[model samples]
Target: MMAGLLGNNVITQIGILVHDIDKVSQAYADFFGVPKPEARWTDAADKAQTEYNGEPSEARAKLAFIDMGSLQLELIEPDLHPSTWRNYLDEHGEGPHHIAFFIEGMKEKVTLLETNGFPLQQKGEYTGGRYAYMDTFKELKVLVELLENDK
Candidate 1:
């Protein structure tokens, strides 16, 4: 078999865009018999250093994370901004957006994906790490998110 770009193929998270986080998070909690995860907003642009299509962006979103043992489910309600989340929600309505993989050497991995046909769509920093969204919809049927956490 051919080698994988990420070395490992374990999916860490699945992200879904939503119009209303409160309702959706609660619904998921009810369905799963788990406590509703608290919803919160992403960091400010200054802190997140968010970029879309290579341009700086102030896009933010309300988010909630549901823990499902080995996998995580993320719900996002984007603001009226030009971030990747906003673009995906506007273009595709509320639904699954991306599958995420946690990785190291983010810059190199991002470059590898871009060189291999998957282009970078958006990227940003968070508290303990950073994330990049790859435009892989045409090939993989869903966008891909690369998350690099501080170790």
Candidate 2:
């Protein structure tokens, strides 16, 4: 079999899709003994609507960005309608949804993954970085993200 997406990059963040942002955020804060994350809203999040799996939804996400030493944690809660987060929450219940890996040459990496037969499930850019999600998780069973930090 072809080698899996190759790299030893450090995991920069863990995205947790939660049904109750407050509760979840609080729990993490308590567990880690750190103050709660400062909440932020971004149009970047709204763009995820285009990637939904036709679950008949209106997608809105309020995100809280938390800093845990050098690592970042994102707490996401979807609003009022079903979404990828909502679907993941429904199927798996509020918890770690994805792990992001910091990468170099993101577009080239995406090309490599695609050429290796693992086409992207979604690709998008946000304020601090660009991200590509590969659907190889179906067979590989792990949500893999190749992230290019723009900072």
Candidate 3:
């Protein structure tokens, strides 16, 4: 079997959308005995060339990550900014939001996906590299994210 996104790992993180990030992260850590996840807040994601529903967004989200053996569990609480987080919350009411793959050659991958007809939903640039969320819910029944961190 082929490992997808073969850079650091395949499907490295599963992102969950929630109303309260700290609450859920604490609950998971306390109840499940998992290590507490590192929490951080993202910027407005404007410079990442973010577009929500085909428009620029000033969206921000609180993110937390718990490191599993190979995979990771991410918790995201969308701030009151224009983002897919709000859309997922409004439509699905807090659940598995997206599966992220850590990879290299981000622009190539994004362009490849776009060539295959998976239009980009949102993208943002962080300290290292960049990331993008693809709109695949219609066919795959879930959103997909691509991350390139080792810039």
Candidate 4:
């Protein structure tokens, strides 16, 4: 059997960049009639190991997650630092960011994407998983994120 380059096309989350995560999170919650999830900041640079354009960066973002069925919606408000989130927000104001997928072999998937013209943008670790953002906006019309949770 054959598989797609990145293995599968299952989208797990959709990220949105906003000016204020707290306000946006509340708006989304009120619109959906659900409790507003608390917004929190990402780990520090040292802990998250955040990198932007192949260099270490002190980029951080306030984030909140809202589950909608099997898919999740992520709200991001980036700080004044160099990162994919910050760049996109600066260039395009505020709106949708990326669609995310959960993948197993993060290294291999990132390499495959890079080889296929989707360069890795920013990457960092969270509490239970790590994530990679790929520069697929030109071709795919939006960025793509790969999430790898520790087993």
Candidate 5:
């Protein structure tokens, strides 16, 4: 079911760019009285397919996810190359990077948002899902990520 927000899925996750995901995740876990979330890095092979500013990039970020019931907190540590995470850290320092929402038609949603001035800043795939970060910081004050899974 589509969430009420924007007539689409709800904000299911909050993405943060951090200097050290392991450390930051641990801190968050400790504060919440939970175990540290599992960490995974974007595959080196998959890295080549990632895009930053519409060009191929090798950037990879170590990711950790904590399920807070319906909503999740995502931590990202940009380990290599230049990506949206790296750019956020370099330009704005460690903080909230994006608010993520799961959608049905990933490509179409991305295109729709783009036409409204939120261009795709970066995009990549994981095991069964893909995500695209739209550059909305300038107008919306926060980057928005569109996630989709073939589940």
Candidate 6:
């Protein structure tokens, strides 16, 4: 098997699952001395449903986009439903959920990881990019995501 492609060539967004959107967003804003982030919701996301491990459910999340220097920080609060953010909060409190890496070959990279014994924990795509989660934490304890630059 070919070695998986992993590199820090791109600086992507960092997603944090928060219990309180206002408080968490404020903390970052104050710390960075940046203005408060704008809160937004996605109707497409609200209407979108996903199948997780064979269970079908809606994926609705409130989002706040904050500019941190050159990088953007996305703070997500899942509505009163079980979602990926909710699951992460339940397991690891409110903190960093995933780190997205910008790459050229997303499908090929995902296949490489899957074929090399890394089963997908979750996979989804938004208007901006696509993402996947691999259950290879013992060796690589971070959520890996490949994002296409939408500029």
Give me the candidate number with maximum lDDT.
1
Tens-digit lDDT track of model 5 for 1-151: 5553334657899998899888999999999999999899876635437888988888888889999999999998997578898888899989899999888788888888878878899988877888899988997788998888887
Tens-digit lDDT track of model 6 for 28-111: 889989888877764443434353443665656788988666676889887766666677778888887777667666667777
Alpha-carbon runs more than 4 Å astray in model 4 = 1-3
lDDT of 1 by residue, 22-121 (tens): 9999999999999999999999999999999999999999999999999999999999999889989999999999999988899999999999999999
What TM-score goes with each of the models? 0.97, 0.74, 0.86, 0.97, 0.91, 0.78
- RMSD of candidate 3 to the truth, in angstroms, is 2.6
Model 3 Cα lDDT, one tens digit per residue, 1-151 = 5454334446788999999888899988998797778779886555555667678888888899888888888899988876888888889998998888887788888787878778888887776778889887888788999988874
lDDT of each: 0.95, 0.69, 0.82, 0.94, 0.85, 0.69
Q: What local lDDT does model 5 show for residue 101?
A: 84
Per-residue lDDT of 1-151 in model 4, one digit per residue for the tens?
4257767688899999999888899999999999999999999999999999999999999999999999999999999998999999999989999999888899999999999999999999999999999999998888999999999
What stretches of model 6 exceed 4 Å from their correct place? 1-8, 43-51, 54-56, 149-151
Clashing pairs in 3: none
Model 1 residue runs over 4 Å out of place are 1-3
Judge candidate 2 at residue 114 and give its lDDT.
Answer: 83
Each prediction's total of clashing residue pairs, residues at least 3 apart in sequence or on different chains, is: 0, 0, 0, 0, 0, 0
Reference-based lDDT, residue 149, model 6: 51
lDDT tens digits, residue span 18-115, model 2 = 87788878888899998987665534444633344423234556789788877889898866555556667688777777777777788788788889
Estimate the TM-score for candidate 1.
Answer: 0.97
What is every candidate's alpha-carbon RMSD to the true fold?
1.4, 4.1, 2.6, 1.0, 2.1, 3.4
